[model samples]
Target: METLPIVPDAAVGAARHIDEYAAAGARYVTTGQQGAANTQRAYAGDWRRFTAWCREHGRESLPADVLTVAAFVTALAEAGKKVATIQRHCAALSKAHQLAGLPTPTDDRQLKTLLEGISREKGVRQKQAPAFTLAYFKRVLQGIDVERLDGVRDRALLLLGLAGAFRRDELASLDLAHLRFDEDGLVVELPRSKTNQKGEAEEKAVFFSPDRRSCPVRAVKDWLAVLEQHGRTSGPLFLSFHKGQRLSRRRLSTFSLNEIVQLRLGAPYTAHSLRASFVTIAKLNGADDAEVMNQTKHKTTDMIRRYTRLDNVRQHNAAQKLGL
Candidate 1:
């Protein structure tokens, strides 16, 4: 006969703590639904790190007063931590306190004061991320030999990232069912991504081959055939052979497009460079902003335009036209 499973008392008690807290103000803030999963998880991690710090400092996380928070922030700053990192910890602490039905130490007044002080000290400014270029990508691709697993993985990864304009997280989440190929071309279906439309994570589709004559289309088609040869059907498309599981978002990030560039081409580039390259390449190929936006699934055409850097050929042609 089948038997019912038993629950550990300690585990049950810990869950009760969360349920009691949830009954308070936590439910009003975030339901841990929709796209807030990442936010919630981030806050939770921040809280854990804060609690660990608190224990070392001889204080309780929940019951700590404003003085403790001030001391923590001051100590963090003295330790040479960035203002953003300190703000993350503060945000986490505020959220955790609110959830626990305790008085928030970092209220609006505190947050405003901290922000103003940080701005004055650090000089508030936004730093633009480095963009990827085609030449850099080509150099990276050249480093990989198609005969090895790493090569296969890198080739498949670089193409998917560039062709599909997939985010690092989405890259790790790719499964076999996400791809479909026929005589016409290849279609990649992303059920959920960083930018979801209407609160339902967006599904992305890409037609690399407009008329069955694109190198990108042919490359991905070849990769799919190799995937089939492994006798694999419906699981993570980017598998981590070491773990024998799907690739993780964090792990994928460790070896970014920059590392890929450095490894293959002896240059540094970020993962989003592939995205920029995609936009620029698409535009040069005569695709309009709307067409590129649809492919990239960018919420705004303006943002898409930013990624579509001007190619040298276009610049030279425009210069010649000016002379004419």
Candidate 2:
């Protein structure tokens, strides 16, 4: 909440204007109806970077002049920043301008033209997928002792993430009533999911039908029992130690999955990788693509195919079947 530094007489007005603009922008961002925590964080980061850049360049706080904004962006791009990065910066600047009731800096036709040109020039692509394997997942689980509260929590998280193919946000949003254990197996109801589905989000369930009695359902049941023992129920499933507050998706970085994968597993993995792992393992165990898609709430069969098909593993298993 630090105030922007005051500049000398020349651009003093502009400096004050910029500071006001930034303050207004923060207020506007917080007022957004779109409640995605990640979106809020990204917007905050982008604007902070833009303001810091302005400070670095000895420019007044407010980017009131379109030309000054243009030159600043150009300098950013010239310094080897990626097109996506530049676009994010532009987006932040545009938002601040809108909040400040100033003219949109990124709205200039010339600026967009330059952005397109730079995008085509770079041809940048998303980074490669994080490396994750079953062995690494096991190691991460093994590292935590089952005696502690956190250990039980981590185990539940890991199992549900792999067994249910849950996104981190969905996992965080779950409540006690979302789960039910009958004699058959475990049933999970996802009331709020991030999909292109209609209405109040589609509800789905995953049944653990393993040959053995002690299956994934058993693991979930045990976790729940531990929670019951600790007198936890019918609230935010994952609570933070900070005054026992309900953990938000914004706290997802503290999940330890990525840290475990990178440090212990020595493999690059993310929350999404667990989703992929579920689809792949289910298919390997003879579950059809349709079934996998249903559990994952995937709308497209084509998208399911990409995750379920472990090409190299299939080929290797086929060879083994032929005794080759």
Candidate 3:
């Protein structure tokens, strides 16, 4: 029988150290659960793409050099990726490198200059989601049969989403316990949101409309009555149902919220359209930047102005007021 050579203690120790380092790097990559689910998924995908590119080019991805990063970004630009998307990919790669105890290439002046050049060459015009205006909302209401359980739930969702300028994820994450009803209207306590990532509690008030048909508060009450009839006094504000119409304890997902809007409008409106529509409609109806921001919870006036400017192009144009 052939005798196997014994491995040295130093070689064994080095192998163990390599294994521990790899394990730690992997743990660092996946340990943090910060940000929204969508954001996390996007970052993961971006990092995977970067790693794949590095493997293809025989470069070290964790400690990516500045030239490699610049080339990667340039390739992305050549492939017609949006400037924002390229920037996000860079952020993901930098974060991964940082977590893995490697130096990030993001601070390199050459990489920064390349990104700036790409941004200038590509132009940074983001496509905005179309707004679902009040007129369109009224039309949707006319088609709904509120007598049905689904209709009742949809009406409440639509009104609340519109009036509160809520993101789809925010609406889907709501619980019955977070809502308070009074003579004035309804108050919703949001535990966490995209803006409030630290899980800070934020309160949003939705007032009653004079018209019962258009009143968000009344619509919520109606939905709650149905829930009460079903003996559902707790858990998610919106629940899923079986084909037999029996309610399940499962909360509605954000994707479902998007589907609800698209089905109601019979158009390509997304869940974000509700929030954008609130801003656009508010601006069109003479609401100032401060007023719009108060409801939308926008951190900066610049974003509010973007929505207002689109609506104001025709309605509030200074050139239109002047006779040529």
RMSD of each: 8.1, 6.6, 6.7
Task: State the lDDT of candidate 1 residue by residue for 25-51, as single tens digits.
Answer: 234334432343456556666665665
Instruction: Tell me how far the alpha carbon of residue 287 in candidate 3 is from the true structure, in angstroms, after superposition.
Output: 1.8
Clashing pairs in 1: 132-273, 258-269
Query: Which candidate comes out best when scored by lDDT?
Result: 3
By TM-score: ranked, best first: 3, 1, 2
Query: Model 3, 280-299: lDDT tens per residue?
Result: 88877878888888888888
Instruction: Using TM-score as the measure, name the better of candidate 2 and candidate 3.
Output: 3
lDDT of 2 by residue, 157-206 (tens): 66677778887667767778888777767777777665732336455565
| Model 3 pairs in collision | none
Looking at model 3, which ten-residue stretch has the lowest summed lDDT?
Answer: 1-10
Off by over 4 Å in 3: 1-34, 100-102, 309-312, 318-324
Pick the winner on TM-score between candidates 1 and 3: 3
Kindly state the number of residue pairs that clash in model 1.
2
